[model samples]
Target chain A: MLTLQFLPYSEIEPLSSNSRIRKILNLVRENKIVLMEGRLKPNEETDLIQRTMENLSKDFKGIELCTVYPNVKDKFLKGLLVNILIGDRTGLTVVGPANIVKEIKRDPNKILLLTENVRRKRKK
Target chain B: MIIRLRDFISNVFYKLFQQRKSLKLGIYGPPNAGKTTLANRICRDWIGEEMGSVSKIPHETRNVQQKEKIKIKHKRKELTFNLIDTPGIATKIDYEDFLKFRLPQKEAKKRAKEATKGVIEAIKWLDGMDAVLVVVDATLNPYSQVNLTIIGNLAARNIPVLVVANKIDIRKANIKKVESAFPQYEVVGISAEKGHNVEEFYESLFRLVK
Candidate 1:
């Protein structure tokens, strides 16, 4: 069975970058796709990729991550003022394990998440 | 002594110009995209040497390799820069994947650990580069997330980039696909291994530095 978990920005706001990455990685390892309310910082994303590479093993492959942010260029002044105040919390991030999530293709219009089917054997 | 003073001032300006010519050009792309091959080709063409070793296995280049003071001359136009060939960036790196290449368990794990470090180092070196050669495997899909992320980061920094669609000798190589993927940037197709259309690539380098 496939699972999709939603994590709000507030839930991770208080945590450090490492802690937030760990929390999301744990969910991805369990084969659950995490839909985060806000995107990670740029350095945080690099750290997450490095951490994922370090944790790759037999059962766990890694993660497929992508973020969709609104084009605030159209409203540059308002966007800049709002960013100055609230720290640019305006995007959705998706993280899924590579084993289960075959691919996550995102264009300007929409996202196409493809997954592979795995059959479990019944216990004897 | 006015003539002597003028010569000294001219020498100072010449040194400064030489310093400005030493731009850093980084080669970045996904795994097995022929980055090392291209770096070696560039080095051999100019400096009569090779930069790094190449292998069919992914992550063979698990560290950043650099060749400095490479000068290329084309049609009386010359450009000098430091060439940095970085490890291929990837979202996933499983040690078991290395075992498929017949590597021992211990060796594979060590390679994976070094590869993770290499990826971080490559990203960290981005700030120091003056120009970049974003290498893409012409036979593969050009719209991958890794490619997009690397290009996006460079664009955000307003860095000068020249996309190299490598391996045009292969049957499945499609330069048009890569061109369509990055329409905004200039894409040059070349068989880095076989040395096809490399003269055109060298000419493009002059435009990139400018």
Candidate 2:
């Protein structure tokens, strides 16, 4: 009898920024609720949102985004005040399937996650 | 006659402003036990909107969702409360499990981190709760470690608890198993999603807060 060998090294793959996005999406897809730390820069956050919206299609249920900032209410000027105070300390959370995060409902940040099929209980 | 008149006025004053003290009623349970659904049902009937979203996924409520000042009126008896929907509790959370949903490596890890933090937040919120509704899925076994831990915490804090046996609409649902598991606390059986027997749930709430 000949011996056979099987090895799986999938978990060892190095993580990247894109892979990070993929991982977060993977969590949402599996119906697992996740809370991500750290915020993308304001420009980066907007870019990500724009890119996601531009890429949306019929196959996705959309993604949810919730951003948190220091609870500061001070604004001295209409447009110039925000530039001084919101100096990159803000953080954001993106939740949804990898394919459809753009389709998330409401403010993505205020959303709570639920697996797609877990919602089968009848409602009144 | 003067003594009786004084007692009557004092009682009326107590009945008006004092009866509506804002009690914070936190809704706690394991995943997908219809906590949010029940909250939404109560709000829609009174507040005209749902509290938060509900879905089939576990931890759909990762944060503590709040809908304040819901006044329940039943047969002229009334109660005012702030309803809080807390994130589902679990013994373990792994990033790899999230990968099963086809998420990539980074996002799954991020979610796992957030979820771990969320669990801590839920536990911390316990101190602020005046009473809690321990929502449980009637279709599953009720003797799990998660349920016991939740009940244990509530007991330790002396917080008033009412066990909600949710999902009675399903054929497999068994409310008695839940009741037997936590015989110390009163259990109310109702389908949060289908809106069946919700009036009974409200009646139980008035009793819990009273």
Highest lDDT, which number? 1
Where is model 2 more than 4 Å wrong at Cα? A1-124, B1-20
lDDT of each: 0.88, 0.66
- In the range B38-76, model 1's lDDT, one tens digit per residue, is 999999989999999999999999999988889888998
TM-score of chain B of each: 0.93, 0.87
lDDT string, candidate 2, A1-124, tens digits: 1111111122212344455455654555454433554444333332333343333333433345444334333543533454445432233343444332222222212443333432242341
Please report the candidate that would top TM-score against the real structure: 1
Each prediction's TM-score versus the true structure:
0.81, 0.57
Q: Is the docking of candidate 1 incorrect, acceptable, medium or high quality?
A: acceptable
Residue-level lDDT of model 2, residues B99-119, one tens digit each, is 887778898777666665566
Question: TM-score for the first chain of model 2?
Answer: 0.40
Cα DockQ of the candidate 2 complex: 0.02
The TM-score each candidate achieves on chain A is: 0.89, 0.40
Which lDDT tens digits does candidate 1 get at residues A15-35? 899999999999999999999
